[model samples]
Structures are given as structure tokens and as C-alpha cells.
Target chain A: MAEPNRSKDRLALSALGLFAERGFVGTSIRDIAKATGLSISNIYHHFGNKEGLLLAILKTASERLLHELQEASNQPGTPIERFKRLVQTHLQLSRGLRKEAKIFFLDEEHLSPEGYRANLKYQREILDLYREHLLALQEAGEVNFKSPTIAAFNILGVVNWHLRWYRPEGQMSFEETSREVTEFILHGISRVREP
Target chain B: MAEPNRSKDRLALSALGLFAERGFVGTSIRDIAKATGLSISNIYHHFGNKEGLLLAILKTASERLLHELQEASNQPGTPIERFKRLVQTHLQLSRGLRKEAKIFFLDEEHLSPEGYRANLKYQREILDLYREHLLALQEAGEVNFKSPTIAAFNILGVVNWHLRWYRPEGQMSFEETSREVTEFILHGISRVREP
Candidate 1:
């Protein structure tokens, strides 16, 4: 059972790397097999097809992300504290699961109808998680925003777009960059107001 | 000359629509030819091949976007006012060029090396333009942020991600949504501090 689970995990990671590099449309089962050194039949036995492999990868990634988010949500703090933890967790997870996150965006259009629905459901839950925290902050008078939905979208956008331009080897370490992002998201570019 | 230019513009628009729908990899020159009702050679006459057509479309779109940004940058206003105009300009232009914007993000990886470099240069300039405004605001003591570069990325992320979820037929009109985003970027989720 352990051997089987390890092989499946390896296959999923290998597929994710290929999908990220070549895209779902550009990657083929043969390519995945070549990358993993697994027989074509063995790959099929595991995932059924390319779409199956993608669906597995996406499902796993979403579940893991949601689990981390749940942990962040349960942390004891003010809304700002929880929000800070959420932002840090989100960025850290995103950096850690860089390839999986890339697949969630890039090859999303290729998901089968069933896969699409499942993926969208997870995505909505994630968005709703953000909105819940935001609404709590609003109620506590710690934050004011017009629409929780749109505000949530903006927050998610700030973090998600990191996958596009962030370079860990650049000027700032990921820790420093994540801290700056958390500050920007919390306070924005406006001058500090007198307390 | 007008007739040729019109034909070329029509071809680019057609290609953009197809690319957005089918993606650059899934889309074929034959599909483009069929969609545009042009023979293969005629399509070739306009753009050497599918890659050339995509390159042409991307180049034209970037140039037009930069031109609009330049106009917004030239507007008379304080940095915040100008930033508002820039945000409005970006959202409006993004709405107007929805297909182009979609193509810019979706099919960008397929660009040839030369095309990739050129596209990246234009994108960098756009980011740099945002940073300049942000830096000015920082200098004037209007805004307090650690890194102008990261702040600019956050601003752009908020708007660009609009292309993913923004719907013209949704609850808020483009004007209203753009206003909300501008406000969010200017100030963030924090409550207004008392002077």
C-alpha cells in the first residue's frame, strides 16, 4: 500500500511539473510516462487518462490549501491577526506549491465537465473563506470595505498574482516579501493616519 | 491603404477571438483561416503563419495599451488623481480590449523567443510606469510604503485579475467597479484613522 501511494504521488508531481512547463494541452501521456519512467499502461492504470491525472493533482492541491486555510482560520487572534496569518499562510503555501498553483490557473480550462465543477466548488469555498474573515474584520470595525465579495477578490488577487512575478532569489527573501505584502494588503499605500 | 489596414485589423481581431476561445496551442492556422474566410495564402500574406499572427496581435495590443497609459500619465493631476485616472484608463481599456487582454495572459507562453522578449519589455515598461507614479506619491508624503516596486505589483494585480472575474453584465458597472478598486488601492482594508 505504501509503495502504491508513493508511486501515485510521484506520478502526480511529475505530471504537475510537465503540465506547468508545457501546459496541459501541450503535454501528453507519453511525455508524462517518459518523465516518470513509468510504463504507459501503468500510468493509465493509475490515472485512467491525462484528464484523470490533472483532476487528481488539482483536487489534492485544493484540499491541501483549504486545510492550511482552515488551520489559519482557527488560530486565536483579532481579525487583523488572523488576517495576517491567513495572508502569510496563503503566500507561503503558494510559494511551496508553486507548480500545483500554476496548474490550477493554466490548465484549468482543460478540466473535464466533472472536474471543472469540483475544481470550481473548491475555488468558491476558498473565496468564501476569505470573505468570512473579511466580514468579521468589518464587523469589528477594524476594516471598512464596500463589498465583501469584491474585497475578497482583491485580496486574493494581490496574493495569487505573486505566482506570476515573484522571484525568491531576488532582492527580498520570501519572508520579507510576504511581510511587506501583508502590510500593503492591510494598510495600502496611504500615509499613516494619526492614531 | 485604409482597406488593407482594415482587413489586417479584422484579421487580428478574428485571430484574437479564436485564440481566446481555443488557446494558441489548440487553435490552428486552418481554424483562423476558416474563421476569417481567408485562404491559407491570404492569411499568410497578412501574417506569415499562426505564430506571426499571434505576435502581430500581441504587439499591436501592447502598443495601443502603452499609448493609452501614456495619455493617462500626461493628464494634469496630483499623483493620486493621476493614479485614479490611470486605474480608470486601465480598467476601461481592459474592458474594451477584453480579448486582447485575455490573449496577453493566456497564450503568452507560446510566443517565440523574440516575441517573448518584446512582450516582456512592454510589460516591464507598464509596470515601471506604475512604479514611477507610486514613487512620486511616496516622495510627496502622500503615501507610505516600503517598496514602490512591490506596491506597484499589488496595484496592477488588483486590476489585471479583473480580467478573470469581472463581468460587464455583473452587479456593478465597469465605472463603479473601477472606482472601488481605485479606492482599495489608495487605502486598504484598514479603518480610517482619526487625526
Candidate 2:
């Protein structure tokens, strides 16, 4: 049982790397087998097919994100603080799961019909978690945004776009980058004075 | 001249639609020819190859965006207002050129080595424009953000992410949506009291 599970993990990790580099459509099952030193039959036995591997990677990615978000939401804080925490949490996860996050954004459309629907369900849940925090902030008279839905997306856009530019080995550390993002989302670029 | 230009336009438009739908790698010259009612040889005559078609589409998209952004930056306004105009202009263009924007984000990697560098140069110019406005605002003491580079990217992320969700027949009009986005970037979700 342990040996088979190890093979499955190897296939998933190899597939994730390939999918990130070559994209899902461009990466073939044989490529995954080659990367993992596993036979084609073994890959099939583990993942059923390439689409199955994609779904598994996506499911793992979404589940991890959802878990982190849920924990953030449950943290004790004011609505605004909690919202900031949620944004920070998202940034941290994106940085850590950079490959998975890239696949989430780029290759989601390649999922089979049923897999696409399942993935959408996970995505909507993530969005709703953000929306819920914004709704709470609005109720507390802390935020003045027009639509919670739009506001949620705007915040997500700011965080998710970091994937394109943020480099760990680059000048700015993740700490600095995430802080700047959180502050920008909360107060924007305009100078605000405390009452 | 007229006949040749029309053929080029038709080929470009058809290629844009196909690339957006099937992706750059998934799309072939035969597909473009079929969509435009032109032979494969005709496509080759106009584009030289599929990569050439992609480069043309990207060039047109980037040029139009730069033109609008340039106009916005030169407009008579305070730095903040000009920045808002830039954001609004970006939103409008993204909405108008939805397919092109999709291709820009998803298919850019498929460009040839030279073409990739050219596209990157265009992208950098656009980013620099945003940074310039933010620098002006920062110098004027109208805003206080850590890094103009990160802030510029944040603003772009908010605008570009809209392409993923914004719909014409949806509840929010482009005007309302763009306005909300601009306001969000300028002031964020926090309630700001007038000084």
C-alpha cells in the first residue's frame, strides 16, 4: 500500500511540474511517465489518465487554499483585520504553491466537463469566503465599496496578479511584498489620516 | 493595396478569435485559413506563419493600449485624476478588446524568441506609464505607498483580472464597473473621511 502511494505522489509531483512548464494540453502522459521513471501502465494505474492527474492536482490545490482561508476567517479580529488576514493568507499560499496557483489560473479550462464543474465549485467557495469578509466589513461601516462581489474580485486580482511578478530570489522579500499588497488593498495608495 | 489590406484584416480577426478559443499552441494555420475562407498559402502570404499572426495581433493590442494610456497620461488633470483616467482607459480597452486581451495573457508565451522580447518591451512600457503617475502622486504627497513598482502592478492586477469575470450583459455596466475599480484603487475598500 505504501509503495503504491509513493508512486502516485511521484506521478502527481512530476505532472504538476510538467503542467506548469508546458501547460496541460502540451504535456503528454508519456512525458509524465518519463519524468517520474514510471511505466505508462503504472501512471494509468495511479491516475487513470492525464486528465485525472490534473483533477488531482487541482483538487489538492483548491483544498489547501480553502483550508487556509477558512482558518483565516475563523481567526479572532475585527472585520477589517480579518479581511487583511485573508488577503495575507492568500498571498502566502500563492507564493508557496506557486505552480499549483499557476495551473489554477491557466489550465483550469482543460478539465473534463465534470471536473470543470467540480473545480468551479471550489473556486466559487473561495470567492465567497472573500465576499463574506467584505460583507462583514460593510456592515461594520468600515468599508464603502459598491459591490461586495466586485470588491472581492478586485482584491483577488491584486493578490493573484502577484504570481506574474513576485520572485523570492528578487529584491523584495515575500514579507515586504505581501505587506505592501495588504496595505494597498486596505487603504489604497491615497494617504489616509487617522481620525 | 485595398485588396491586400482587407485580406490581412480578415486573417488577423479570424486568427484572433481562433487563438483566444483554442489557444496559441492548439491553433494551427489550417484553422485560421478555414475561419477566414482563405487557403493555407494565403495565410502564409499574409502572416508568413502562425507565429507571425500572433505577433501581429499582439502588436496591434499593445499599440492600441499604449496609445490610449499615452492620451490618458497627457490629459489635463491632477496626478490622481490622470491615474484614474489611466485605469479607466485600461478597463475600457480590455472590455472592448476582450478576445485580444485573453490572447495577450494566455498565448504570449507561444511567441518566437524575438517576438517574446518585443512583447515584453511593450509590457514594460505600459508598466512604466503607471509607475510614472504613481511617482507624481507620491511626490505631490497625495499618496504614500511603499513601492511605486508594486503599487503599479496592484493597479494593473485589479484591472486585468476583470477580464476574467466582467460581462457586458451582466448586472454591472462597464461604466459602473470601471468606476468602482478606479475608486477602489484610489481609495480602497476603507471608508475615507474628507479632510
Candidate 3:
């Protein structure tokens, strides 16, 4: 990356780190500067203020997360397969972008009014993607649900909460967690006995 | 209730609201006092400081949630009935004590180290209650799982995240949302024929 790009990346990454550790209101410009090894004034060269840094980080992560989802959905597969792909991609992203993902979940609310609205617009669109896929699966008789909104929330809540307790070196790898959680969310723990 | 009891209830409720909106670091003694129409000195008479107020809320809410769970679990009936009672009671408590619950969920880290550990002790007790119940269901062959944690996560996450989007007056009452979410979680959307 070029000089400005490198600085922005540093700012975004540092912002992510600090924001994740100590929420948005808790993080200071000095803290971000210290994390990035830049002078506070120099930090301003890349992002205007604390809120500016937050907006940049959220915009970058939001776009990246959406891109990952789009790529997964475009792959050839069964509806179930596509759903699995979505869960796997999300789990992988959550691991790779641990700090950024944490900040995204925790601090996006700190954005200025306009930025907050835009960020939520993107968030709702991503949620809508899940809703659409779920509705399709329901109509195909793959699942039983009357409300896509409830379905989407059920799926997202189960998958996204992995950030809180999912450990990379724990007994289960991220992939295993993804597979098991995905199946659990899509299919319950019960099985019918063979006649 | 006596005046003193009502006064304490108002104090705890006000503490929860400030803690939720401003967070632990952002809130001040004066802020809590202002919210409750008392001087900071008067507030101090009840609890030593912000930490005391927070500690009281956490202790009180934890006891409230588990007590409700115990009541539900003891209600007259079978395993399914017991589970439904647990779900309904949990959902009701989650709605009524949302601010305190959110503090437990998102703001526990802000507590003093001792407070944090103490809070965890209570939380672990409640989580164990849910897990042990699930274990009983599984041992009876009522539940089957490749990963028990995932199943538990789905059940709790669906209920926990209810605060995020559940409206006071939607097409579904809190009771209906509770029943609907629990039913979907317990059985999932997958049909037996499809499986």
C-alpha cells in the first residue's frame, strides 16, 4: 500500500483495537495515536477526529463483510449449502477481523447521526439478504417458519455471538464451531427414529 | 410497599437507566442523583458510590432472574411444560429488567475487579441452571446434539437478543414471541420429512 493508504489502514486497525478494548466513548484520540505510533496531530492527517476515525473503520469493515457475504451467495450450491457457506464465511471473517468485528458490534452506535444512519442502512441491507435467503428456504419446504424477521434474528444471533466465546485455539477450531453452530441453528438436536 | 422500599426501587431503576445510557465510566454520582431528584450526598447515604449502586443492581437483578426461573421450573407439569414455563418466565424477566440485563451483558467489564468476579459467580450459577436442564433433556433422548454448547447458545441467544428488537406491542405479545422463539429454537425450522 502507498503512504496514505498505509496510514489509513493503521488508523483503522488502531481504532478497531482501541474501540474494541474500551468502547467508542471510552477511547481517546491520544490512545489511537499511541496504538498507531503516530503523533496525535499526525493521526488527524488521516482521519479528522475520533468520530471520523470511527466512521472510517465502520465503513471499511461493513463493506468488507458485505463483500464476503455476496461472494459466498454467488457460489453454486443447494439452499442449505448456501446457508452453510454464509455461516462459514461469517465465522472466518469474525476470526480474521476479531478487533474490527468487535468494534463494529460495539461502537458503530457512536458515529455521527448521518454516519450512524448510513451504517444502519448497510446493516439492514445485509440483514435483508439473510431474510431473503431464509424466506426462499421456507417456501422450498426446507424449514418451517412464518416470519422471516424472526428467522433471520435466530440465525444471526446464534452465529454472530461466537465472537464473545469462540476461541481459536480452544477444543474446537473456528471451522468446527461454524459447522456445528450452523447445523444447530438450521436443524435442531432431535432425530426421528427409523421405522 | 413502604416509602423506604419505594425509594430503593426508584434508586435501583434510575441507576440501571444511567448505567445503560452513559455506561459506567461516563456516568457520575451527580448524574444519578440528578436523575432521581436527590443530591449526590443524599444518594451516597444509600450506597457509598457509583460502584455500590451498580453492585446492588447486579446482585438484585441476578437474584430476580434466577428466582423467576426457579418459580417457572417448579410449576406443575412434564418436561415440556417445565421448559415452557422457564421460557415464559425468562422472556418476561428479560423484558422487565432489560436495562439491568444489558448492563450485565455489555457493561460488566466496567465494574471493579472484585465486582466483576462476583457478578460472574452469579451468572455462572444461572447458566448452569440452563445447561443442567438441557443435559437432563438430552440424557432422556429428548435432545440430541453434536455440540451441546451450540444448542444452548441458540436457545439463550434467541431470548437474550429479544431486547434488541422486540416491541412492547407487536402482532405477537411477549408471551407469543416467547413461545414462538422457543418453539423455533427447540424444533428449528427443519421438518422431519425433509430430514
User: What would the TM-scores of all predictions be?
Assistant: 0.93, 0.94, 0.89
TM-score of chain A of each: 0.92, 0.93, 0.87
Given the true complex, what DockQ would model 1 score? 0.49
For each candidate, what's the DockQ? 0.49, 0.53, 0.43
How much is the lDDT of residue A162 in candidate 3? 74
Estimate, for each residue in B1-81, the C-alpha lDDT of model 2 and write its tens digit. 646588889999999998888788888888888988988887788778878889999899899889988987788988777
TM-score of 3: 0.89
Per-residue lDDT for A120-176 in model 2, tens only?
898899899988888888778746576889888888899899988888889999899
lDDT of 1 by residue, A1-195 (tens): 547577777888888999888888988888888887877776778888879999989888899999998897779987878877888889989998898888887776667789889888988999999889888877777454677777888888889987688997888778777876777788742333657
What is the Cα-based lDDT of residue B18 in candidate 3? 84
Best by lDDT: 2
Tell me which of candidates 2 and 3 scores higher on TM-score: 2
Off by over 4 Å in 1: A188-195, B5-7, B188-195
lDDT of 3 at B111: 71
Tell me the deviation in Å of residue A153 in model 1: 0.4
Off by over 4 Å in 3: A188-195, B1-9, B169-172, B189-195
lDDT of 3 by residue, A20-77 (tens): 8888878888888888887888667777777778887777878888898989886988
Model 3 has fnat of 0.35
Task: Report the candidate with higher DockQ, 2 versus 3.
Answer: 2
